[model samples]
Target: MLAATKRVAFGAAVMALAVGLAGCSGSGGSEADEGGTKGAPGAKKAPGPENAVRLIGDGSTAFTGAQPNITPPQRLKPGEKPPQFVVFSWDGAGEDSQKLFSHFRQVAKKYDAKMTYFLSAVYLLPEEKARLYDPPKHDIGTSDIGFGDTQGIKDTLRELRAAWHEGSEIGTHFNGHFCGKEGGVGTWSVEEWKSEINQAKSFVENWKTNADLPDEAPLPFDYAKEVVGGRTPCLEGQKNMMAAARTMGFRYDSSGIGNQIWPKKTDGLWDLPLQLVPVPGREFETLSMDYNFMYNQSGTTSGDPDEHEYWGNQMRDGLLQAFDRAYEGNRAPLIIGNHFESWNGGTYMRAVEDTIKTVCVQRDVQCVTFRQLADWLDAQDPATLEKLRGLKVGEAPRAGWPAFTATDTAPADRTEKH
Candidate 1:
């Protein structure tokens, strides 16, 4: 699925509005987190009791106790500044000939960062077993992104396990990659979404059986509990998807578009959507995703070879521009999305890696996964968050961080309107 050509087109107007986990300590997820105020630093996992690895159904996943390396989120002190959170996420995550999934994992570790990998379950279901997926509106075994081969499944499984052990999040990109009005996810009923969600989880929970890898070690985390959120295919079907996701205990949803502002709960889940960032030299902004940038710059995956370098730098600089606005202004979390494909001669991958290296190392900046961001949000005072939300995108408080959040007001829960 990583190598498939994505033909979905996102317009700038729609693009501007879209919205779009622990591993154990020292499991070699990343370098030890350096202690910084409000920054989630890398830490060692407390040793689990003997025989803590209890395998789940078909031995595809296991219960491994609390995820390691995650620092318990603490409420912000009266005058504390919020950390500048930068989330790097991937959709339909898998490993193929390009090996982007594994490659990015190493990049995150080297930069002291953790990311969210939204796995498309079809990647684990071999082509011969494709019929196992009953997509909402498509024929059985149909997937626009295609299915995995035996070796692809094994390689993807290796990355998933290591990523979890290293403290990154593993979310669901659902199954079949269906979109559009004809039986696409946009038309799915809440129950149908539920079915798709269940099927996605089932594939992960039973890959050992589906892929005939019976001897493989179970995934280190219980996916049912671990997968708390995801970005939908093509960023479609969010309204009903959130409805279904909330009922399923999802803590967040990233299927919408927004400015670089603080997030709030919508429909009982954190509405953490992808954001609009400048396109560097362009007059207008676009969603902070590689595909959207590619859509606007070259309009196709294979654009002019000469322009590849320029296109990549534009994305990297765009992300940095967004990061700077947040880091120096309202301190809103900068949410970014990407895929494992080497779109535009792997320029997007390079852009992502460069952005990570540049921003994640900054003091008081936490380059973390969505799960960690949600945890931090949950830890903050509602009144403080309300005040933070009042500050518009790229707007900082006049009196500064200390006086701005000095006192908590008793405001009702601020739920976002979709």
Candidate 2:
């Protein structure tokens, strides 16, 4: 999926119209407050000052209270079975005529799931303000995907505000959708990538100033703090991009390919690569992304309408098979990537929606954003994680978790025995 030639093209008019628009702490409690049904002894009260909202930079973003609907991550107890994690993420997420972004938000809510929307910065910059973006290696104001119009920006903002309030994460897909060798992201240097990252941040932080929509309510969360990770454009330039991301305090990078195994750190950051999954009715597997599936199934974004339903079922079944492999075996996190476009008569959308409804409601299954997944990973004990990493793709611990982790208590003895 990281191949430069895998880039998808969008209509210029569609691109021009989509410019888009578009934390907490605790403290000690008093004795009376403790007994007054407020909270347990020494437990922090809910809805306290930690939820207070503080406006930031041109009022484009704010430090709203703790994100709603996100459960705090707890360290996994020794020998405990891990939850089956499934992450459904979208690239270049925005609102347009198709309404795919908003539709997916509703789908997530219905299934008790949260998603990561990797927004393209240009979607917020109105077509009139195109010159504000100086894309790396591209001509001034030149974006392969054009800027959004006023109405498009307004709709995107509405959806973004609502999505965050519902506990969904907002990430970046960088600026331009540049891929391949000619000035594409694959050829970018660390410095060029840094410039692009900064520009992406700047566009989000100054949307109000640049677009002149002063009266609009500020975004609910601070972009700088909210955006801790992102998938690079077309999944290219990942090596240099990771270098830039580490310097920018990013916690994870999801722009590579890997098998269904536990994630590990790269350059001190989580390398949460997309995994290969079964392709229904086929002997081979493919990247767990809608685009990859579409490419393999139809060889183009828009395929035969007569086979749309079949394609949808194929994707849905493939993802489920992949989910079960990890769920019943190694228990590795399943990462699924998608886009907002209605490829193959919107069959992929339907497939994803059905997948969410089916998988998220199952026992011990958590459909979460990359941010939440990263938090859970960070909260676990290193030894347990190391044990998890030892499991090969789809390979469960034959001795079960109890015996598998029993060596933690006698590391030195285990070493000597080995």
Candidate 3:
């Protein structure tokens, strides 16, 4: 989800004048809080206990696509049930896809969690395959970025089949994101949407070429014959996404949310909408201020992870609140879609895990993955899908938005991690 460029400018001013990214201590799953405010240099403070306890209800994760992108008769698509699952997808970031894929598998085991993971063809490298447990224990989903000039679509997913099985499921992450621009944002003609959609479909359906990655520093591989049956990137609205999904032959899409374009007239696409990911108070300014701050502060990005500590903590706290709201309210369960690169095997992922642990154990909360949710939904009658939260105005929250005391002071710029 992209913010307006105009709002970005205002945020830049706040960062430069009010919060010049004063360095704060950084932690990777470690419990530590550094001093944040009160007119002094970055200092250390308490972050409280590891109170990662029950805080919400049913959870699910969706990757761009998973467990064999478009499997052949993989037990007819499950019937519909209550859509309550968690989804986590990622573009193949840099060259650490395997590291990330392996790391999360361990995390999942520890929590007794099952999740669907979307993988770009690039991630199915020899290095990545080597890390996999025999028989492919993890759920592998496919996300193709055809917008990139290099890797071909069929060649991308074919690479996955050659690398691993059982865990592989082909699905589309749409054509943007890993390719840049659009970042999955929309406003394109439906035809343009079809062109990209069809390209992914064609690749997934016909990827039997059995090609190999190019011999280069960043390995680029050819995909085998495979077809993707799902997609979830930048499908912000119902009509656009519905038209696209129907045209593209997608069975489901892990896009949309209660907060995004909602209360739509159509239910053509199955939505695995993400929840309100917490952004930092200062992040709004980071994007707007990156350029100016580089010149102002020793040629560097203005809001490094160290400088944005409080926002991080606050976001972790807020996610718990969000989980609480969704569970306690009449709304359906919260499904999450997070980018692996966003966490990149670091403190951020741990923070999210902390929140997840807190929520999964909650009295009402029952954690699940997109596959799990879809299986549950598939088993139910289609009518149940109509009764979901993202389809209409979700049940109002049990608690009102926290009433912040607004003096004459301006609202502090805010952002949360997705």
Candidate 4:
């Protein structure tokens, strides 16, 4: 393990802030942060219906921590700021025939960017990166089915289901790879959406339900978790899709990147928005403005030294850009996007490796996963989440000292929070 960097004072700060949080809302309790500090946990009210998700700082503040394990240097330093630490993530976390995942993992390992790759069609897809880690940072995944060929999508899902026993999670990647700008992410027919989810779950979890294996070898991922923690084909930000996801038993979706807060069209599922990943965007000039991007080492790449050269370099720079923005704007996390297939091309892998090296050495940033972020939010005071739900600079009275822990009754409500 890379030498653990000295911890930050966020814990102490959190405690102090919790007091005020408790003031405005009735949320209080203990907190556990390794060698940090311990406070109180909120009282467990009746588990509200899915739509009644009432928790402070829920989903507002998060850390997307993950990177492929095979890439080169990507270490994070203490007190490192975003651009680097403000990590985002990609679903379909797996090693393809081109060794894309292995390459990206190297980037993750170096930067300490704890990424969570959503596993899906990576099952029998192809092992471009030979002799890879059995479970490639397999956290949760989307696009379980729909491999385009439609040929063995079913068989492939079966093998993946076996891995699911260990730690691979499944989510929706789209009804049938129906991606692109105009794709009907939130506007898909109800039955079509239902079929997409139902099929993926059924095929992906075949071993779980019909397994005759001994109980000792538990599954790798959680099938019962509704693993719907992903986005659709296109980056079409829509409320209808959210509402549909909720109705379909999904708790979260990584579809919305730019937009913050639970959209009004929520179907009760959590929106984990996909910010920007490392893959190249539009063209050369479109590089710098590449705030939110996706990466895959399997596509066409530019060797342009500045912004176009190796996508890896561009991503490193992008990380810096995101950090500056978050620090300047107080944004807690930065979500990047990518695809398993994207990392398959020629130069793409090299770019991924280089980018990984850049992220590993950065400081102050804590790479986290979607689930971890949600958990982090779940642990925070409800009021804080509300205040941050739709973070806007002009929205006077930003988060400050004396972190409020109590949401049910907080002082901020009277003064500025509300």
Q: Which segments of model 4 are wrong by more than 4 Å?
A: 1-87, 106-113, 121-170, 180-187, 207-219, 236-240, 259-267, 276-312, 341-364, 389-418
TM-score of each: 0.88, 0.86, 0.50, 0.53
Clashing pairs in 2: 19-123, 19-148, 20-123, 20-153, 21-153, 22-157
TM-score, candidate 3, is 0.50
What's each prediction's clash count?
Answer: 12, 6, 57, 117
On TM-score, the stronger of 1 and 3 is 1
Tens digit of lDDT per residue, candidate 1, span 257-346? Answer: 788888999978999988889887768888888877887777777889999999999999999999988888889999998887677798
On lDDT, the candidate that comes out on top is 1
lDDT tens string, model 4, 267-307? 55555654332222423211111212222221122323343
Q: Residue 368 lDDT in model 1?
A: 88
lDDT of 3 by residue, 94-135 (tens): 123224444554465465455454543222222222222111
Tell me the whole-model lDDT of each prediction, alpha carbons only: 0.80, 0.78, 0.35, 0.37
Roughly what TM-score does model 4 have, to 2 decimal places? Answer: 0.53
Residue 374 alpha-carbon offset, candidate 4, angstroms: 1.2
Candidate 2 per-residue lDDT, tens place, 339-363, comes to: 8877889898889998999999999
Using TM-score as the measure, which candidate wins? Answer: 1
**Ten-residue segment with the worst summed lDDT in candidate 3?**
22-31
lDDT score for candidate 1 against the true structure:
0.80
